[model samples]
Target: MILKDALPQGRITGTGSLRTVVQTVFDVLARFRQYMTHPGNSRFEPLFEIAMQKQLYNLLLEWLSGETTNSPDKVETTAVVASWGIFGAAVQWSRDPLHSTSEMMVHRVSEVAAAALAPVLGE
Candidate 1:
């Protein structure tokens, strides 16, 4: 459901599709946070994290590829960078001392991601 509904096909730029993708990634992470709150308890944490990030990357890739104008190579690269950026910020949000809300995190990540992917997701 996450990837399938990530973005509308074609004309995604400047139409809030990017925000949808970012929100989906955060929503998935928020669900995972329930099970992964304590990373220190597991020995396979590093492997688990890599797998999770890969899933997020694919989610963004699905959205990027929805637009026919994006080249295959560029879609993969942008997805990789944006996924990492989103996941990295999510990790920080989890570790924050003030414990900001997920809504705030989603909004902040959306802004940063839109800027980061402007070349491909924007005009």
Candidate 2:
């Protein structure tokens, strides 16, 4: 429930593992996509993009920093890489109408991310 605890109330609420975090991220991305698609909010798309990336990056940084036992440099690298991977996957998920839902996508992303980070983190 790390992600649930970290996110604001009503954004993402649940208790689980990395799937919870991925689902929360997907929910956030879906909300941002909705906001950006609004005609009045279109002008702020660039700012929203940056904010979303920063938010994910910070969240990953904090999460990985606590989860990993690696050195500072490795942890930082892993966090950056994982954040980008997760963010990129979320972006793609938003674009694909057929796969827009979080049910399968979130778990897949979580598995891939966990696999990628496992070796580096010595988990």
Best by TM-score: 2
Error at 7, model 2, angstroms: 5.8
Candidate 2 global lDDT? 0.70
RMSD of each: 3.9, 4.2
Q: Identify the leading candidate in terms of lDDT.
A: 1
- Candidate 2 is scored at a TM of 0.76
lDDT of 2 by residue, 19-117 (tens): 566776788767778777767887886786677767666766666677667787887888788878987898789767474457788878888988877
Superposition error at 24 for model 1 (Å): 4.7
Clashes of 1: 0
Off by over 4 Å in 2: 1-16
lDDT tens digits by residue: candidate 1, 44-75: 55775687788778766776786547789988
At residue 22, candidate 2 shows an lDDT of 74
Error of 2 at 91 (Å): 1.0
Worst 10-residue stretch by lDDT in candidate 1?
A: 6-15
